[model samples]
Each structure stands twice: as structure tokens, then as C-alpha cells.
Target chain A: MKLGIDAMSGDLGSAIVVEACRSFLSKNKTDELYVVGKKEELLALESYSQVTIIDAQEVLEMTENILAIRRKKESSMVKTMMLAKNDEVDAVLSCGNTGAYYASAMLFLKRLEGIEKSCLMAMLPTYNDRGVALLDVGANSENTAEQLKSFAIMGSVYAKNVRKVSNPKVALLNIGAEHHKGDEVHQETYKLLESMQEINFIGNIEGKEILDGDVDVVVTDGFTGNVALKTIEGVAKVLVKSLKDGFMSSTRTKVGAVMAKPALKQLMNKFDTKAAGGALMIGFVKPVIKAHGSSDAIAFENAMNLAFDMVSSNVVDKMKEGLK
Target chain B: MKLGIDAMSGDLGSAIVVEACRSFLSKNKTDELYVVGKKEELLALESYSQVTIIDAQEVLEMTENILAIRRKKESSMVKTMMLAKNDEVDAVLSCGNTGAYYASAMLFLKRLEGIEKSCLMAMLPTYNDRGVALLDVGANSENTAEQLKSFAIMGSVYAKNVRKVSNPKVALLNIGAEHHKGDEVHQETYKLLESMQEINFIGNIEGKEILDGDVDVVVTDGFTGNVALKTIEGVAKVLVKSLKDGFMSSTRTKVGAVMAKPALKQLMNKFDTKAAGGALMIGFVKPVIKAHGSSDAIAFENAMNLAFDMVSSNVVDKMKEGLK
Candidate 1:
């Protein structure tokens, strides 16, 4: 398998991407990587026979406008998408501005044949340890009932193939678990999902139940999904900060923190979003993974591994067949 | 101040409400409480001089239909709302079915004059401990831009008078921080909030920033607001559970848990939703506070105290002036 890695544009810069490429190639000798960035910055990966450095003249800034992807065709993010478009790589990975990468994917690889609107899907950690697939995290601000139905189909396919959940139980995220709970579009989408025979529709699931790990797939419009996803991240961050503050407040607690470091590390790993890897732009023709903006070397390498898994599992092809 | 308490419908039953009323009356000598419930269930409050037990034959189940409030007029929730409607009580508090309580408040107390829609406003704990007020948390499944504008005005009044934040800053909760993000109604609401001279309209706030304690009040449509609020609760619960599991995994960690218990307790208190009290049914003619259905004695008492504060601060009257 071959992967295209955008070596610039992440918050940590190209050094982490180069390190990630080095680590990933060391583990998977059969897989090849096309690392796109300034040639001088990625010199560290030059020794690896499986890695090819493609120099790009420009780098996309984190806050650059999405339309800049068109103007800066030589930028790492745009160039990596081009590699995927030309079939030089089976999958593409980036830790850049989400908007620019999403736009560039649409401009180059395009959507699957039956897909109307593409969505960003994230795997959120759940209590039971089997993560749940949540779709339309921030692809489109507003989605039609039919568009949500499409998300349900694609989410089911991704959960079944990538997450390996057989006969995935799909649900619509709403204010209440009742069918009549949300807005007009959601209420209409409920009927559409319930009538579908190809997927296991479990009616509605509330936001509070999303992390309970009861269902395999949860679907919503990009707006609400984005809010839910970020809210989870915010709460986790604040709590962890508070916990550290608590542990450091006094001599006794500081001692306790030292004693419990191993257990605490295990707990953090259980809830770490980085371990779950990047979000997948599911409706595209090839797998497109968006690593977190603040990804470290390990997180970025995990994203590449996710891209490889998507390619190996034939997720995009299965999603196309499911949509049909 | 005079307050009405619905004693029968909470998840913990009338015992906790009776205990809460006892604690409240003991602390507040001048205040009177009209506790509404079954006569047999609320006999424990008969000894207090400031407590009046109103006999209600029925209880609203947690899953009861919203329209049931009209039919079960003798239900404790409906009877409590009637106390506020008839001016027999300055404020009303309930830990019953949220839908039933909200509907009863609308049917009895009615919306304040000139208010287009009433919103449920929750006080979420923030890092700074000042907390942020999030509005329209499930009052209406959908809202017009005008309705969101009204929420901004009312939320500002709430923060200033009830929360005691002078010159409070209000923000619109959107998927992104950009002024042009979110659905069409939110885009129009952004312009409306920006033009409002009475409010300190801070452009847009994302879900991730809600708990950062940067803004005083955040407004959103009911559906999105509800999702965000519950998502916060869900993540916090899951993390705390995981932390407990981690601490209990080994004997060394168990010793650490004992040593860290005090500091951890302090941290938990800082983020406790109970300490912040209940969600207020804003835009009503009088303050109508809905305590958590799963509230304990302390949470129930806190809700009553919140109603007392709302009534004492004259939040409803000040909201009317702001809307005018």
C-alpha cells in the first residue's frame, strides 16, 4: 500500500511529520510513503528506501482561506491530494486546516458516484472501549433529510468495514431519544432511516448516550455534530487540567500523583483522541484522513496507519456499494 | 420571599424534597415555602411554621406527555405552577418531567409580554468558577432569528441580575467562531445580535470555548443548545467514571486515591452542576426553575435557593424592561 502524507501545515510543523514517516516506515516495510514538503525540512527521512520526498514550494497556513488551496497548487496539502487524484497513492493524510484539506479533496478526488454530500467522520471513545462512529462532524453546516440519510448509509459502511462492527446499529443524534424530538429535518430523517433495510436503524439516541457505547453509529447534521464533538473535547481537556491542578495542590496529593502515575496514564490512554487517529472524509473516492491540528509524531503516524487500514479494508468501495 | 416546591415528581421521591425544604426553611427564616405533593407523602414538612403543604393527588411521571399537564391539573408540577400564576408564590421549583414542567409553566405563568418564545437556560460550570449561562437548552426544537435575539437580551439580563455579572458579555453559540458560520438562522441571528446596542455581543462562541470562562452568556437555538449541554454532561460523567476505575485497579493506586481524595473532592465541587443549581425557564412571567430530575437533597435545596435568588433579584421584571 502507498500513502501520501502532507509534511507541512500541522501545528507542530514538518519535523513531527518526518519523524512520523520514519517510525511508520520502520514498522511497515512493505508500505511506501510520498512525503510532501520543503525538501530540506524532510531530510531526516531520506535514508528510508520506502520514503520519497516530493518538494513543494509553499505551505498552507493553519488559518488560510479554503479557496487558497486552488491558488497555492504547489502547497503540500494540495499536492498530496493531487497524488491521490492521480492514483500515485492509495490514500491521503493531512494534519492541516480542515477546510482547505476538505475542499482540496473535493476538487481533486471528488465524491463517490451515488453520494450527494461528503461528510467528516470521527471515532469517539466510548465507555465499553469499542468506539462509536459519528459522522458529519463539520462537512456542511446544514444538511437535508436526504443528506442525513446518506450519512447514515456511509456511517454504517465505515463502522462495519473500518471499525469492524458487524451489522452496526445506527442511530440519529437528537435532543431526545424519542422519534418526535428534534427539528423538522431530523424528524423527517428518522422516517427515512427507519425504512432503510440495508442498515440497522435504532431510532434516536440522545447526546448523553453517544459515549455509552450502546450503538455503533450515530448520525447528525454537520452543525450539531461539530458542536457535540468539540464539546466532548472541551470537557475532557478542562477535567484533565483540573485533575492535574488537584494533584499538584498539596504535598500529600503530589506524592499520591507520583504513586498513581501508571494507573492515571492507562486511564488517559483509554480516552485519548489521538489513539483513535484522524477523522475520515468518507464520501470521497479514496480515503482522506484529517489528523488533528495539534497532532504529535505518534498521532500523525496513527493517522497514516488509519489511512492504510482504510485502503486495505476497501472502505470507500464498500461505502459505494452500500449506497447503491 | 415565597416559593412553591413540587415535592412528588423527582426521581428520589418526596423524601429528598421534604429534606430540602427543611434545610432551606431552617436557613431562611423570613422565607415561606408552599410544598405541593400528596398529603401523605409530605407530612414530614407539617411541623415547620414557614412551610405549607398543598395536597396534590397526582404525580407527573418522568416520561409523561407534555400535554398531560393540562389533564392532570391536580398533579404536583401543575399545582406548583398554579401557585406562581396566581401570585401565591414568588417563584416555582420542580424536579419533575422537564417537558411537563415547561409546558405547565407556559400554560399557567405564560410568556412575559413581548417575548416571542421562552428558553431553558442552564448555568454550566466553567474553569473560572463564575460559570456560563447557556440558553434555549430545549425549550423549542427550532427558533427564528428573532427568537435568538430575544434570548440574547434575556440571557444578558439574567447574567447581570441573577449571576451578578456587571456588564455581562453575551455570545452566540455556533459550530465555529466565525461570524459567518452555522446555519442560515444563526447567520441572521449573528447580525441581529451584533446590532443590539444593549448587549455586549461577543461575535460567536464554539462549543469548545463554552467552558473556558471567557464569556458570561452563550445563546443558541434549542436543538443545538440541548445537544451541547448534554454532551458536556456525558463527557464529564464518562471521564469521572474512568478515573474511578483507574484508581481502583491496583492497591498502590488505591492508596493514592485515599491521599488524593480531598483535592479530588475540591475539584469535583468546582465542576459540580448541582452547586450551580437548576435550569431556569426564562421568559416566563415569574421565575420557574427546573431542578435535575435525579437531584439529591443538596441539589434540590440549591434549586430552591436559585429560585429565591431569582425572585429576590427580580430577574423577571428586569428581563421585561430589557425586552422593552
Candidate 2:
């Protein structure tokens, strides 16, 4: 499998991306990598037989607008997608500007024949130990009933093909479980989802239900999905931090903390998004994996694991057939 | 202050509501209670001079539609709102159907003159130990930019008057902190809020910023707000449960658990929504507190504590004056 990495983006900069790719390539000798970034920076790195450096003149900063993809045609993120578009690489991965990466994928790879827009599908940890696949985490802020239906179909395919879930239970994200919940758009989307037979539509699910682990896939528009994802992350961070601080408060608590450290670490791992690797930019002609902006080398490697799986499983083709 | 209690509603019925009122009235000697429910079921309670029993013939179930408020005109929830509307009670509290309560309040309270809709404002726990107030948590699923502006104004006033955060930093909730984030509704809401002089608009805040305790009030449409609220609640529950289960795994851990119990309790208390009491149904003519549906008598009493504060501080009148 061949994977392209956008090294000039994200919070940690190019060095972490390079190190992560080098680490992955060293172990997975069979896979090849095309590291896309500035020529001077990338060429200075130690060479490996499986790695090829692709230099793009410009870099898309996190602060730049997504329109920078079109304006800066030679940007690393756009160039990486171009390689995937040309079939030079099976998939691409990024820890860069989320919006720019999304825009570049849409511009270069475009959507599949039947898909209107692509969704960012994230694997969220649930209490039941079965991860839930949530779509449109921040791809499109506003979505129509038709767009939502497309998200359901795409999410289901990703769950079944990539995540290896059979007959994935797909639920529309809403405030209430009622079919008539949310606005007119949601009501229509609920009806559309309920009528679908190919996908295992489980009616409506709320934010609380996302972590319950009952449903395999949860689908919603970008705005609500983004809000829900961030809220979960924020709360988890606060809880974990608070727990750690409380454990270190005094000597008595520190002893207790030592005894409880293993248990606490296990619990924290269950809710870790990085453990799921990265969110997939689904509905494109080719797969694009978006690692977290602050991802470490381990997280990037895990994301590459997901990318390799997506390539091997032929998720793009399966999605095309499913939507058809 | 005469507070109306919807006794014939919520997970636990009239008995819990009656007990909660009794508990609140016992210590809060200055406050009076109007318990609205079926005359037969409520007459069984030991009467106090400060408490009055108001008979209602019907009840609105959680599964029923919000329209049931008009259909079941004699229901406990509706009757309680009517009392507030007629100035028969200073405030109202319900641990019942959120939609039904919102409907009845809108019908009776009539949105405080210039207000287009009332909001459900929740106090969410943050890492800073000072919780942030989130508005429109499930009241208006789809909202206009104007309505969002009104929410910011009302939320700011509530934070200032009730929560006692002078010059509260109000923020528009969006996917990103950028000037142009989220959908068009949110983008327009940001500009409107920024232009408003009455509220201290802090620009756009992401979901993660909510629990950071940086912002005083976070405003969003009901759909996003509700999802975020439930997501936080779900994660908190899961984390607390996981921590408890971890503590019970072995003898060494059990001993540590005993030692850490007090510190853990303090950390959990920081995220406890019940201690902050219930969400205030703001932007109404009078305060309408919506306690959690599964709340016990203690939680309900805490909600009444919030109601008593809102009434005493003239939150509604201050909101009306501020908006005007």
C-alpha cells in the first residue's frame, strides 16, 4: 500500500509527521510512503528505500481559509490529495488544517459519483467497548435531508467494510428519540433513514446514547456532530485532569493513586479518540484520513494503520456499490 | 415567594415532588409552595400553612407531544405555569416532560414582551471550578439569528443577576473560534452578538472552550446546545462509573479507594449538575426551573433553591429591561 502524508500542517509541525512515517515504514517494509512538504525541509531527512519525498512549494497554515487550497495550488495538503487523485498513492493522511484538507480532497479527489458531499467519520469510544462511528464531525456545517441520507449510507459502508461490523446499526443523531424530533430538516432525515432497507437504520439516537455502545454508527449534520464530538472530548479531558489532580493532592491520596493508576489508565484508554487512530474523510473517490492536530507519533502511526486498512479493504469501491 | 410545583410529573410522581417541596419549605421559612396535581393523590400529604394544594384533572406523559399542553389544559405542568402566569406563584419547577413544560411556559408566559422564545439555560461544570451557563439547551431546536441574539442577551442578564457574574463574557457557540465558523446561522449570530453593547460578547467559542471555564455564558441554538449538554452528562456518568468500578477491583485498590473517596467526591462534586440544581427556563415572564427528569427529592429541592434565587433577584424583569 502507498500512503501520502501532509507533513507541513498541524500544531506539531513537519518533524513529528516525518518521524511517525519513518517509524511506520521501518516496521511495515512492504508499504511505501510519499511524504509531501517543503523541498528543503523534507530532503534534509534520512532516506529510506520505502520512502519518497514530494515537495510542494507552499504550506497551508491552520489559520488559513480553506479557499487557500484553490489559491495555493502547490500547497502540501492539496499536493498530497493530488497524488491520491492520480492513483500514485492508495490513500492520504493529514494532521494539518482540517478545513483545508477537507477542501483539497473535495477539489482534487471530488466526491464519489453518487455522493453529494464527503463526511468526516470519527470512531468514538463507548462504554460497551464497541466503538461507535460518527459522521460529519465538521465537514459541512449545514446539511439537507438528502445529504444526511447520503451520510447514513456512507457511514454504514465505512462501519461494515473498514470497521468490520456486520449489519451496522445506524442511528440519526437528535435531541430526542422521537421521529418528529429536531427541526424540519432532521424530521425529514429521520423519515428518510427509517425508510432505508440497505442500511440498518435504528431510528433516532441522542448525544447520551453515543457512548452507550448499542449503536454501531451515528450520523448527523456537521454542526451538531462537531459540537457533540468536542463536548465529549472537553468533558473527558476535564474529568481525567481532575482525577489526576485529586490523586496527587496529598501523600495518602498519592498512595491510593499508585494503587489506582493501572485502573485509571485503563478507563482513560476506553474514551481515547487517538486509540481509534483518526477520522476518515469518507464519500471521496479515495480515502483521506485526518489525524488529530496535536497527534503524537503514536497517534499518526495508528492513523496510518487505519489508512492501510481502508486501502486493503477497498472501502471507496464498496461505498460506491452500496450507494448505487 | 410562592413557588408552583408540578407534582404529577417526572420519573418519580407526586410523592417525590411533594417531599422535595416539603424539604425546601422546611428550611426556607419565607417561601410558600403551591403543589399542583390530582387532588386525591396530593391530599394524602401532611399540610403546612405555607403550602397550598391545587387540583389538576390530567397528566402529561414524557412520551406525549408538547401540543398535549393545550389538550391536557388541566394537567399539573400546565396548571403550574398558569399559576405563574396569573401571578398566583412567584416561580415554577418541573421534573417532567421538557418539551411539554417549555410549550406550556411559552403559551402562558408569552415570551416576556419582546422575546420571541424562552431558553433552557443549563449550568455546565468546567475545569476552573466555576461552571459556565449554556442557553437554549432544548427549547428552540431551529432558531433565527435574531433569536440567538436574544438568547445571548437573556443569558448575560441571568449570569449577571442570578449567577452573579458581573460583566459576564458571553460567547456564540460554533465549530471553530474563527470569525466565520459553523453554519450561516451561527456566523450571523456571532456578528449580531459582537455588535450588541448590553452583553459582553466574547466572539465565537468552540465546544471544547465550554468546559475550559474561560467564558461565562455560551449561546447556541437548542439542537446543538441540547446535544452538547447530553454529551457532557453522558461522559461524566461514564467516567464516574468507570472510576468507581476501578476502585472495587481488588483489596489493595479497595483500601486506596477508601482513602481516595473524599478527594474523588470533591472532584465529582465539581461536575455535579444536581448541586448547581436544574436548568432555568429563561426569557419568560417568571422563572421556570426544569430539573432533571430522573431527579430525586434532593435534586428537586436544589432546583427550588435556584428558582428561589431567580425570583429574589428579579431575573425576569431584569432580562425584560435589558432586552428592551
Q: Which candidate's lDDT is highest?
A: 1
lDDT of 2 at B89: 91
Pairs that clash in candidate 2 = none
**TM-score of candidate 1 against the unseen true structure:** 0.96
Task: Give each candidate's fraction of reference contacts reproduced.
Answer: 0.74, 0.70
Docking class of 2: medium
Tell me the interface RMSD of every candidate, in Å: 0.9, 1.1
Compared with the real two-chain complex, what DockQ does model 1 have? 0.81
Local accuracy of candidate 2 as per-residue lDDT tens digits, B1-324: 888889888888878787887777678777788989988887755468888888997989988888889889899899999998898998999999987898888788867877887788898878887789998898878999999988998888888988889899999889988878888998898888888889899888888778999999999999999999988888888777877787788787788788777679879777778777888888878888999888888988888888889999998899889888
**Model 1 misses residue A60 by how many Å?**
1.3
The most accurate candidate by DockQ is: 1
> On residues B1-324, what C-alpha lDDT tens digit does candidate 1 reach at each position?
899999999899999998998888788899899999999988888988898889999999998889999899899999999899999999999999998899888888778888989989999999878899999998899999999999999999999998889999999999887889999999999999999899999899888999999999999999999999889889988888888898999999989888888778988999988778889999988999999999999999999888988999999999999998
Residue B31 CA displacement from its true place in model 1, Å: 3.3
Docking class of 1: high
Fnat of candidate 2 is: 0.70
Clashing pairs in 1: none
